[model samples]
Target: MAKIAINGLGRIGRSILRLLTTTEAGEGFEIVALNDIARPELCAYLLKHDSVFGLFPKAVSHDDSGLTIDGTRYPLTDNPDLSQIDLSGVDLVLECTGKSNSREFATRGLRAGASRVLISGPCPTADQTVVLGANDEMLGDQQVISCASCTTNALAPLARAIDTAFGLVSAHMTTIHCYTGSQPTVDAPRGDLVRSRAAALSMVPTTTSAGRLTDLVLPDLAGRIFATSVRVPTASVSAIDMSFQAQSAVSEKQINKMLAALPAPIFGTTTEPLVSSDLRGRPESIVMALPETHVTKSATMARVFGWYDNEWGFSNRMIDLARRMTSM
Candidate 1:
């Protein structure tokens, strides 16, 4: 069987393993090795009990030998120098540590001996950036690739689908996002005062690269799409509040129909009054809150809500892009 390696056993790295080992979507790839700055036991502990996903429904243990989940042991390494870690048979390395978002670090991942590298976050200097179902056809013979940010994964598909169904004239999006591992629990230095506040206590407004990166994925909406983000006191799912001005007028019914008609896996529509936590384990890239769909009185502008389990869905997308890269 083909093999893979996880360079950082962070939220994304662990989620990738879960997608490959725990679920029905558990794919053909086997994670043969792991690299992280933390100890294997700590990594195992976090993997076994995710605050966001709940307890992993599988036997989990770790030792100097390796980290085992569901009775399958994967060799674990904690070398601070990633290139020093062996990835001999690793077809691809998932660069999820979030520490290395630069070309220099991405190249270091490739140096670990994998045929290719798939970054879980944006790496503009990466050979190519892709969001599956949107612009994956643009994937070429690139050694290092990025899946972009979670916000891009959640927004790009809707952009592509809406742009295809009805011409997108201009769009302004605000991602009502959840706090990630990056934010500190209490007020501390985070390179900015706004983001330095307590993560669980307040909503912190911040910038997002989703629009610029989305433009890279689908050039048609290059300068027309704009986005911002606000980190709320949540741990699992995130949402995008988008107002898209179409080329022509359209009703809320038409907008809802367009969303409902989207491909189920990439874009989903739900009529239920679901909150953020309700979407905690959803695998779809973006789920339209059907009842919340709104259109301007003039019908030229439509407002919609999209929810996504940032970590879970993005991890799934990593698997999808990884499978595609390995196939090539």
Candidate 2:
């Protein structure tokens, strides 16, 4: 079986672990180790809600260091540094730490014998940035991979489709993203200057790096996009609202046809109204094309909606990408 290690057990990290234990997609891989600085309660919560494995069985072994699931006992290491982990047998390392991206972290995993490291957030190194479907070919053996944020995952394909079909002129997007575990329910001292405000009560305007990363993934559209984000009061399943000005005039039917042409596993289009709750627990990050609103005016602006269970959806893709890398 493929062995995997996850670092940082926060919202995304915990969701990844749960996905590995509960989902059928994770059958070929085993989570050999998990790391987090949170209290033990956090880890216990993760072990309790697995959809497939459920709570850890009584026969499972536990010690002051770590617990064993399915006869694999991963001793918890006190160190949080990615360089310190013993990854000799690990096929892939899922770096879910929300900490700013570091080339050192990816390099450390490679040096420690991990075939590849998949980063949860954007990587500081320009070379490591790649989106799953848009530039999946960029991933190869002996390479570090970074999955761009959820907004990028949702919008890139839409942008790519439009750019390919009608030619993209410029695009602007506003992502109505759900509040994450990283945000405080109550007003507290802001850890990051931008997120210090109350997240539960109000919609906060924030900068999005998706546009920048989009250019990186599809270089042909470089410097042609702008994006912003609003953090709303919801647990999971964020939505993306994208408006694109196509270079060549295209009708609503044409845009819908182009979007619908994408593979179902990559893109989804529907006549039924799509909502965030409808996308909850959805395994793939689905792009729900809004066909009715595609206007065919001078600057053909179309509103496209997409859904992503940011934590689980992105992590699922990360694991699939890892598995493909290891040929497992």
Candidate 3:
């Protein structure tokens, strides 16, 4: 079994462990340690009671020594700096700290002695960036990796599928995303004016890295795709509203049929008029909303819609990358 350490306990971090400890995906991995700046008690409580995912299915408890899940004890600590930790036995470090774009932070686990580092979100400086079906073939001996972001994970596959079938000329993507921890429950100060407002109160127009990151995965589409985001009031799940210019013309039926044939656990298709909440725990990268596929009269231009459980789907991709890196 490969030894693994997690460097954060936020939504993404906890979700990663939740999948690892509870599913067969974690069969050949061991949780060597957990690191978070939050107190051990709060970390344990958060693990026990997740606001969006509900309580973990296994027993969760923590003491000064560490965290115990499903009766297995793993060392847990409140360490602000990973360089100070001794992760000598850890084979891989899952860096869920959203700020890992900083090469210094992404490499901290390596400095601490871990064999590899897999960041949860986008990191331009990472040795490689893997987006499952879109670009996982590029994964090899890279020591520092960015799984890309949740949005990128959901968008890249569909974008790739469209490009593969219809030939992407250019694309514009708009994601109606759920609010995240970066936004406050109430109006407050944040990095910018739009995000500083109450996250749950109204739709806040923001930006997405997928526009640029998608180019990284599908280089042929470089400088051809752009994306934007609107943070909505929901607690989970997000929507992808995309319009693409394809070299080949396709009708609405043709587009849905094309997406319907895409494989699962990565991409899926459904005709149900499902709301965002219905997609809460879905593991697929993106579930194409068949009924929402709209083709222009010219057929050369089209609009598509899909839903994604940003946390769960992205977390699963993280596990996929982690398993590969650990050679599990």
Best-performing candidate as measured by lDDT: 3
> lDDT of each structure?
0.87, 0.71, 0.90
Give the TM-score of each candidate. 0.97, 0.88, 0.97
**Scored by Cα lDDT, where does model 3 land?**
0.90
Model 2 bad stretches (over 4 Å): 39-41, 47-62, 68-75, 191-194, 289-292
Tens-place lDDT per residue, model 1, 1-328, is 5678888888888898877888765567777888888888898899899888888889999998589887788888888777887776678888988866677888776787778888989897888889987897889889989899889998998998888988999999999999987789999998878998999999999988898899999997899899999999998899999999999988899888888988867787789998888898788899899999898788899999989999988888888788888888
Pairing residues by index, what is the TM-score of model 2?
0.88
Question: In model 1, how large is the Cα lDDT of residue 25?
Answer: 59
Clashing pairs in 1: none
Worst 10 residues of 1 by lDDT: 22-31
For residues 216-283, write the lDDT of model 2, one tens digit per residue. Answer: 88898888888889888776778777778876667777777777788745566667776777777666
lDDT by residue (1-328, candidate 3, tens digit) is 8899999999999998888888877888889889999998999898889889997899988898699898899899888899899999789999997888688989999999999999999898999989998997899998999999899998999999999999988989999999999999888999878999998899999998998899998887888888999999999999899999999878988898899899888997788989998898898889999999998988899999999999999998888778888883
Least lDDT summed over 10 consecutive residues: which range in candidate 2?
A: 51-60
